[model samples]
Target: MTSNKEDYLKVIYEENGLERPVSNKVICEKLGIAPSSVTEMLSKLQKQGFIEYEAYKGSKLTSIGGVICIKLLRSHRLWEVFLIRYLGYSWREAHEDAHLLEHVAPERMIDRLEAFLNFPETCPHGSIIPKNGELFENTQLVKMTDLKVGDIALLVRVEEDGDLLDYLERSGIIIGEYIKIKEKEEYEGSVEVLQKEKSIRISYKAACQIYVEKRR
Candidate 1:
């Protein structure tokens, strides 16, 4: 299986491929490719038993494809951890580099790296690192935009956008940090949040991409 196909499976798996089919439009958007290209790739994957696809419906990964996707995720997240903890790479840099490293890293090397990193639960961006043969479930995850005004929550997972990641890091929105939503500008569709005694305004689009944990 090519890494490009693995990448597609990974996205499908993340978007609940095990439970439901994902639209071709979603795949096209995630991959930043044209709809025609997505359709052609889906056809190839389906023929290989990696996925089930319908013309207008969507695509869902088969059991074999799901396993491959998990392995891909494990390698990617492990590399992200190594890059951040050992090489001093920032959150955004780690993800960008890990994307290439994950495809070439050996299984044994990843296993050793996992132990060396003390078996971290997540990557630098707070995304879960799936265990071998283990499925990850994030039922408690909530988008930053869903938080009510004055509500306090922990920044758990961040979408892997380099600019957004850098901006959040600069603004002190680090993972595990407690952020309180101070204001929700209905007209402007932006959110004002308080983090570490400083105030920051987040665009509604960005808020929808960030995930936060419920206050404990």
Candidate 2:
């Protein structure tokens, strides 16, 4: 498959297309492409039986498309783990290279790499790595925006955007860290969180992109 096709599948899956239809606007925004271009591609994917597309309602992956998407995810995430754990790359530096590598690497090489990495469960950004084309679901995850004041949660996964990753690293928001919501700005929707005794304010947009598990 072409890299563009793979990217479209990945974006759709990441946006939770499996659970519901993902709008053309969302796909266009994620890909930074024109709506007409996305429309063309979505039609192509639908005709090819990789997606189910509706004119205004958007699209979702079909079974075969999902299988291909999962395999690509497995390769991409495994590459991220290997790059960070063994190659001494920072978490923020691993994504782009891993994305490039995922499209070219063979399955056998990915299997060996996963073995060499001792089969890590997640990438450096805390997104789960699929195993044998299957993803182990995490049902407890909630968006960081869902937390209320005084609620504490464990940072689990973060959106893999370069600027967001860099901001998170600078703010000491690593995976597995415990964070307490100290305050909420009602007007703007930004939040103040206390992590390791230091207070940090994150924009609502940023909060929405972070995934956490509420601490019991």
Q: All candidates' lDDT scores? A: 0.87, 0.89
Tens digit of per-residue lDDT, candidate 2, span 30-147: 9999999999999999999999987678899999989989988899899999888789887678887898999999899999999999999998898898876789778899999999
Tell me, by lDDT, which candidate is best. Answer: 2
Question: In model 1, where do residues sit more than 4 Å from their true spots?
Answer: none
Estimate the lDDT of model 1: 0.87
Q: In candidate 2, where is summed lDDT lowest over 10 consecutive residues?
A: 165-174
How do all models score by TM-score?
A: 0.90, 0.88
- How big is the positional error of residue 111 in model 2, measured in Å on the Cα after superposition? 0.7
Residue 162, model 2: Cα distance from true site in angstroms: 1.3
